[model samples]
Target: MQIILCESAEQVGRRAADIIEARVRQGPAVLGLATGGSPASTYAELIRRHREEGLRFGDVTAFTLDEYAGLPADHPQSYHSTIRREFVDHVDLDLAKLHTPRGDAEDLVAEAARYDLAIVGAGGIDVQLLGIGANGHIGFNEPTSSLRSRTRVKTLAVATRTANARFFEGDDEEVPKLCLTQGLGTIGESRQAVLVALGSAKAAAVQAMVEGPVSAFCPGSVLQLHPRATIVLDPGAASQLTMLEYYRDAQALNDGLQ
Candidate 1:
């Protein structure tokens, strides 16, 4: 695991986009994308590069991490629309190649299975982007979620729904109680995991995920076991990490070598 402490949220976004652009430049690549405010900046920067720097995503294949179980693909709040509005619509990425879990499928169980197969069939994700939930969940794999779990439908924890209420006109009750998400095991299979967090609100979860014990209670901690995982955070989010100075020193050394 590599921890990169940045001075601000925008820097964190730039750093993350740097990692992603490098992979896309390596040739055709499969990318696992996440939605929400945490990744909005990164997506924005990528869009800027595409428009101002000639960055191309024409050969990239993308997959969304999860979706609200009952939301239609056309719903404004659906991840399908969210991702497209936030990132896909701005880039040259082909809509046909962007795979998102069919949250509205009549048979979600089968849909989850098919989503997993689609990922594997695409040669696996070259780099998976992630966001650490304030409650330590990742892709809706809430507390106590099995470390070896696969893609599946999961009941939304109250806290998770509450946190997401902002997207639903500030009504927690309006948020879906169920969602289909990629499990920790499925996420860990990606070649590279890039998790980005910002603000003091995420400090504790960030600390636990990077420095605490590897337990299912904190799903994001599974990244600790990943062979290649990069954690990008702003100073506020890294505030609770005990080895803050060490991470900064290490990042400085890495920058020098590069």
Candidate 2:
């Protein structure tokens, strides 16, 4: 795993956007996108690029990682609406190329299977963007989740519901009980992955992901097994990491060498 410690959230977003732009330039990028607070700045930066620098999403194919089960696609808190409002509507991405798992599908299993097929049929994701939950979950693959699982509906852990309640007017009971998320195995199949984290609240989760043993307890740690995974974090999020300065300097030297 490679870690990039930025001075702030904006810096993290800019660096991540640079990497994403470079990948998109190589070819049509198949992006596995995540939603929530961590990615807000990154999405904003991408929108800025589109508006000011002629960056186009015309050839980009995007698949969102997860969505609340049973929520209407047009719901304000729905991942579909969030992505549309924050990124999709701001750019020129092909409407047909943007995909999200159907949260309200009657045949959820079939829908999930089709979603997985769509991702694989696109030659797999070129870059999967991730955001870690405070409890160390990624893409709603909560603690104790099977690592080899596939795309499916997941019952939200209580901690997850509580953490996500802020988006639903601080009412935990109103939060959806289940969600459709790509399994850890599916996420690990991507050619590359980037996890963006910020703030002191994320320090422990970041530390667990980067420094602790790879276990189901911390789904985010699965990134350690990926050949090309980047963890971009601000100083506050990197606080719990030991030898952080050394790692930062090493990354700088490696970039210089390249």
Give the residue spans of candidate 1 off by over 4 A.
none
The number of the candidate with the highest TM-score is 1
Tens-digit lDDT track for model 2 on 1-258? 888889989999997888888888787889989999998889999999999998988889999999899987889999999899888899999878989998999987888888888889999999999999888999999998887877888899999999889989999999999999999999999999999999999899999999999989999998899999999999999999997978889889877997
Clashing pairs in 2: none
Question: Candidate 1 residues 59-120, lDDT tens each?
Answer: 99999999999999999999999999999999999999999998899999999999999999
TM-score of each: 0.99, 0.97
Winner by lDDT: 1
**lDDT (C-alpha) at residue 94 in model 2:** 87
Global lDDT of each model?
0.94, 0.90
